[model samples]
Target: MFKHLKSDLPSSIVVFFVALPLCLGIALASGAPLFSGLIAGIVGGIVVGALSGSSLGVSGPAAGLSAIVLVAISSLGGYENLLVAVVLGGVIQLLFGVLKAGIIGYYFPSSVIKGMLTGIGIIIILKQIPHFFGYDADPVGDLAFAQVDGRNTFTEIARVFDGISLGATLIAIIGMAILVLWEAVLGNKGKVFKLVQGPLVAVVLGILYFVFTQDSETWGISKEHLVKVPVPDDFNSFIGQFTFPNFKVIGEPQIWITAFTIALVASLETLLCVEATDKLDPKKRTTPTNRELFAQGAGNIISGMIGGLPVTQVIVRSSANIQSGGQTKMSAIIHGFLLLISVILIPNVLNLIPLSVLAAVLLLVGYKLAKPATFKRMWDLGWKQFLPFIITIVGIVFTDLLIGISLGLAVGIVVILIKNYQNSHFLHIRKEEKTGQEVVKMTLAEEVSFINKGAILKELNKLGDDSFLEIDVRKTRYLDHDIIEILDDFGYKANDKNIDVKIISERGIIENPKDYEMFFNQEKKENLKVTR
Candidate 1:
């Protein structure tokens, strides 16, 4: 992990900027103490990042869980009791990892995964538009369309013009300009430009602008427009920020219910983000899903023990890490340490950075995610892939992350079923050269399942009397029992219809096979039902 310190260190700084505001905003949205989010971010970065097999995935307090956290807090009677649930949830996640439930992540279709990334990208842009123009009504990390501020996504954007802060808007414009300059030209110019990243410059400029223009009537950026990390006056006050869980309510049935809920939701979100992150990885690294779950579980346990929200692998920060050229998990770990040190040593200095500058940074991240080229590429893949991709984006933009992914998965499954029904086998008919008889040859696909039963049956039933039939399974693997039954029944009917049957396979050729089930059973026992 330390081998790429030059790259990882700079990327980690970018992730720190991305994670900082999100940590505080998610905590505020969840109605948890502000410091709890920071703790989760710190633990997520340092602890989970160290343990996880993911090279680039960054975990933290998720906006997806804010609603869940808020309700759990209210229902559990207090934040302390909620922390109990969080700890239990971590245990459950660890159990999930041990059970190898990580395989579930691989089952999600590529179309849906791409859609998720695009949907998140679009959400980031939409959500940050208000902030970019100096309107901070919505919490920084909230991704849902309907907001805690009593306005929907579009309504909030509509209100942005009215609440626009000139200083913030101007600062945001300059920040965006710097980012564009760096991305388009400066970043590739020299090692110096690479070492000193554009985001770091933008943030420093935002701080300097805030410091210099505080007293200027027209140019002043107000407190409401700045990053709001809680500043502790002294050592004891800083330590007091950490809260402990109430163990007394551990036996409560409702507490267990909440714990299970958090574990299930956090685990699902992590798996999905893992899938998306792998897709975005330049090196195409595959994260060990089970290990990732175990790492997240351990992180959550540590976080909850010290007054933090439940943690998950977050896509926004992970994507930012990738876009910023992060090479390893060290970036995530160092970012967490940065969060810890910043809040402890320079909380006041961090508080001086304007929210709009962060918005500019996120705007770039969002664009890379939902690029127009991606849309056209998905469309070119045909309706089977495009439908799910578009639906997922719509669902995410209108609802939330998981809901959008669920909708896309539903559509993707239907597309698969349709494709399977149509592509079960191929049929060819020709006249025998010498005998002048019609010969029908049917070749089964590489894999035949119960879903293909109807299509295969229809083709077999259409075979005419006195015709020669040839069934080919040379390329087939893992034929389902239901499909074997259909072929068996068809063989009997074909014999009665005066159709001469010949079956070909990798094992051997059989003429007019009387017992298809027995033959397949022998093949299954030989472990011949596998793809090479």
Candidate 2:
């Protein structure tokens, strides 16, 4: 760990910069106290990082859950009552880990996953536009098109123009320019600038602008346009920021329902991020899916107890960590500590940083995730790939994350079933057999399911009179009961058509010497026994 500190320290600084605004933003999106988001981020980084087997995966409050959290908090009565559901959600997630439900993540198609990343990217850019222009119509993390303020995504941007803050707009442009310059030029100059990320520089400049331009008549930033971390004047006030769950909600049915929803959604999001992060990892390290569930459950439980939003492995933060050269979980843990220290020691200063600067930071992050090159790449792969990708994106943008993923998965399954229906078996019509009879040979694949029933039945029905039929199952390892029944019934019909039938497989031979049904259902017959 010490040897990797040189790498981890810089990566931690970058991740810290990335995580801060997100923590605040997600909390605001959730309609929970802004401090709750910070606590969730801290716990996600520290507790989950300590418990998880993943070396590079970072956990935190996710934008994907914002809409759900918003609804749950309101439906459950308030934030205090919702905390109970968060804790219960953790218990459910723990059970999921014990039940080995992590494999659910593997069932999602690649196109859907890519679509999710791209969809989220597009949402971030859309939601941040108002903030970048200095209007605070919505919270920083509100990704949904329909916001709590009754303004939709597009309407929020439109509203920004009506009450634009010139000072904030100017600072945001300057911050973005500084960031662009840092990445394009200054970053390549030396290790010092590389260690100091663009976001950090932009934030410092934002703070200076806020302090210096307060007295300016023409260009002055307002309090609403700045970061809004709660300032604790004393130690007691700092402790007061934490809120505990009300266990009385345990008796409520709706509380249980909300708990289950969170557990399912959070587990799914975490598993998906784990898979995506592994793919992004240059070392290709696989995170244990079950352990990840357990770690997330624990993090959520702790976060709920301490007044925080639910936690999940977040791809955005994890990707930032990887891009910043994080080599181990040390970077994640360090970022958590940084969050803790920053909120405690520099809460006032953090509050001074302009909201516009954070918006600019997220704009760059969003662009990387949903680049034009990515769309072109998906399109080049053909309709089978592009359809699911586009459907997922459309669903996510219009509905929500879970709905989008479900739609994409449904499309993917249909594609698979169609391919299976087409390639169920191979039929070759022979001109003559050894006995000089018109013969038809059908070769079964490695595994036969009931899905192949219609295709197989149609081919078997086409045999003409005085024909020989050979059904080959030599490559088959598993045979469905329906298929076996289909073949048995076909034998009786084939015999009436003056067709002679034979079955060949690794299990040896069965012929329609008599009723084929007897051969499979023989009580004590030794003749039809498997050769192996």
Candidate 3:
């Protein structure tokens, strides 16, 4: 992990900048103490990163869980009680790893996963718009369709026009310009450009801009636009910010429910981050899902014990980590330590940086996740893939992340069943055989499920007058009861069409079967069936 120290160091610096505001923002959104978010970020980086099999993925307090955390804290009586749930949640996640439940992440369709990344990208961009304009009524990282602030991404943007801070807006614009220029122009100049990342440069410039603008008599910048790191007077005072969980809450059944909720949601979010991070990795490294679960569980356990919010592998930070050229887990670990040290040593220095500048950085991150070209690429793959992808995108855009994913999964499963139904039949013919013609032989596939009903029904309807239809299931290993009932129903109608249906199996061929289930089950037991 330390082998690429040169490459990883720069990346860690980038991730540190990207993570700072988000850590604070998610904490605020969760209604937990602001310092708790920083604790989660630090532990996520150091503890989870050290243990994680994923070299490039970063973990931290997640925006996705803010709603759950908010509700849990209130319902559980207080933030202290919520910590108990977080600890229990970590234990549950550890059990999930032991049970090998991480494989469930693989069952999600690729299109849906891609859509999720794109959806989150869109959400990030929308959520940051208000912050970029210096409208900070809503927390910086809230992603819900509706927020506790009584507004949403669009409504907040509308409100931005009324409450815009000129100072913060100007700083954000300058920061964004610097970032764009660095990436688009300066970075192409030579090796020097490659050595310094645009975000780092933008952050440095932002700090200088803040310092220069601090003299309101001359530059006219307001203190409200500046970063709001809580500054304690002394070491002892700063240590007072830490809160301990009330262990007495552990006896409550609701606390356990909250714990399970946190565990399930955090695990899901982590799995998603793992998928998105893998896609973003330049080296295309695959993360071990079960190992990641274990790491996250351990991190959450530590975080909760330390009065932090529950931790998860967050895609926003991980994406930033990849974009910044993080090459190994060490980058993640370093960034965590950076969070810990910076907050302790230079809370005032951090406060000098404006929120708008951080917003600019997040804007860039959001754009990369939901590029327009991604939509076109998915469409080119055909409807089977594209439909679910679009559903996921639209669902997430208009609703919440989990709902959109569930809807997309449902659509994807339907598509899969339709495709299987179309392919289930052994033969496709234009016309049935003529009267007394050589028997029209049809075979069935190995495992016939309920989804194959339509195709089988259509094929059976094609038999001609005075024809013999040989329904062969000799190779079929399993036949659904629904299909067997359909066959039985077809037999009664066969006489009207002057057709005879014959079932061929190990029990021997039978004409015009009376009891379809008995015949099928008896033949299934006796026949050396050949699966199609």
Candidate 4:
């Protein structure tokens, strides 16, 4: 992990910026204390990152769970009782891990995963545009299509023109220039620029702008536009932020139900994100899903024992880490330390970094995700692949993450059913050179499911009485029980219809086969099944 310190250190700073605002905003949206989100961020980065098998995934309090958290807190009576639910939820997640339920992460279609990445990229770009100009109607790091303020992703953009801040716009422009120069020109020229990243430089530039223009009326950035980490007045108040869970509600049925709800939702969200993050990793690293669940469960348990939100792998911060060139889990752990040190020692110092610079950093990350070439590539993959991809993108942009993915998966299943209906046979039919008889020949596909039963039946029904028919399954890997039954029943009827039947399969040639029914009906289905 330490081998890529030059790469990881810079990337950690970028993730630190991305995670900071999100931690605060999600806590605000969840109606929890602001510090709870920070605690989750620290625990997610340090605890989850240390135990996870993923090289690039970053975990934290998810915006997807904010609504659930809000309802749980209100119905559970208080924040302390809600903490009890969170701890129990972690135990449930650990059970899920031990049961090896992580295989669900492998079930998502590749088209949907790519669509999710591209859709998130588009959202990041759209969402950051307003922040780039210092329009603060919606809080920083809110990625939903519909915001808590009743404004949507686009309406917020439209309102940007009416209230652009000159200082912020100018700072953003300068920050972008600094980033490009450092990465494209200066960074490549010498070892000096290689050690210090563009984002860190851009942040420093933002701080200088704030300090130099403090009194200027037109050019000065307001306090609202800068990074707003809450500063504690004294050491005792800082110690007071941590809250313990109320164990009095441990035996309540309602508490257990809420615990199950959090575990289920957090597990699903984490699994989906794990799929997406693995795809985005430049090295194409695969994460162990069960290990990830165990790590997240442990993180949540620790976070709940001290005040914090439930934890899950988050896509936005993970994406930023990838774009910024993070190479290992050290980046995530270091970023957590940065969060801890910044809030405790330099909250006032962090307050000077302008929001515009962070927006500039995110803008580049978003563009890489949703480039025009990606849209064109998806279009070229044809309607079967493209429709689900587009639908996922649209649904994600218009609705939310889980809804969009579910829509894409549904469309993907429909496409598979249609393809199965059409692809039952690989055929080559022509008159035999010597024998003047017409021949009907069919080669089965590599895999056949029950969905292809109708198509296969239709083809077999079209065979003529005088024709010689041949069915081949030598190359097929799997033959469904239904298809085997169809062939067996057809062989019996073909004898009376005067059509000659021959089957060529790995089980050896069989003429007028009629014993398949006896196998399935009188004995076990697996007795005759052959797999290589």
TM-scores, each model vs. reference: 0.93, 0.91, 0.91, 0.93
**Clashes per candidate, residues 3 or more apart or on different chains:** 0, 0, 3, 0
Candidate 1 lDDT over 1-532, as tens digits, reads 6899999999999999999999999999999999999999999999999999999999999999999999999999999999999999999999999999999999999999999999999999999999999999988978789876678999999999998999999999999999999999999999989888899999999999999999987888999999999999899999999999999999999999999999999999999999999999999999999999999999999999999999999999999999998999999999999999999999999999999999999999999999999999999999999999999999999998889999999999999999999998999999988987889999999988899999988888888788898888988877887877777777778768888888888767778456565676676665647333
Model 3: per-residue Cα lDDT over 111-229, one tens digit each: 99999989988998998888888788877767787866566668878888997777778878988998889878887798667677888888877888888767765444566766777
Candidate 4 Cα misplacement greater than 4 A, ranges = 431-437, 506-508, 512-532
RMSD of 1: 2.5
Model 1 scores a C-alpha lDDT of 0.93
Residue range with the least summed lDDT across 10 consecutive positions in model 4: 519-528
Q: For residues 471-526, what per-residue lDDT tens digits would candidate 4 score against the true structure?
A: 88777777777887787788778888888878776656666346545533421355
lDDT tens string, model 2, 186-277? Answer: 97899888777777888889999999998886798988888888899899999999999999879999999998988998999999888878
Candidate ranking under lDDT, highest first, comes to: 1, 4, 3, 2
- Per-model lDDT: 0.93, 0.85, 0.85, 0.87
Question: Candidate 1: misplaced stretches above 4 Å?
Answer: 431-438, 495-498, 505-532
Candidate 4 clash total? 0
Give model 4's TM-score versus the native structure.
Answer: 0.93
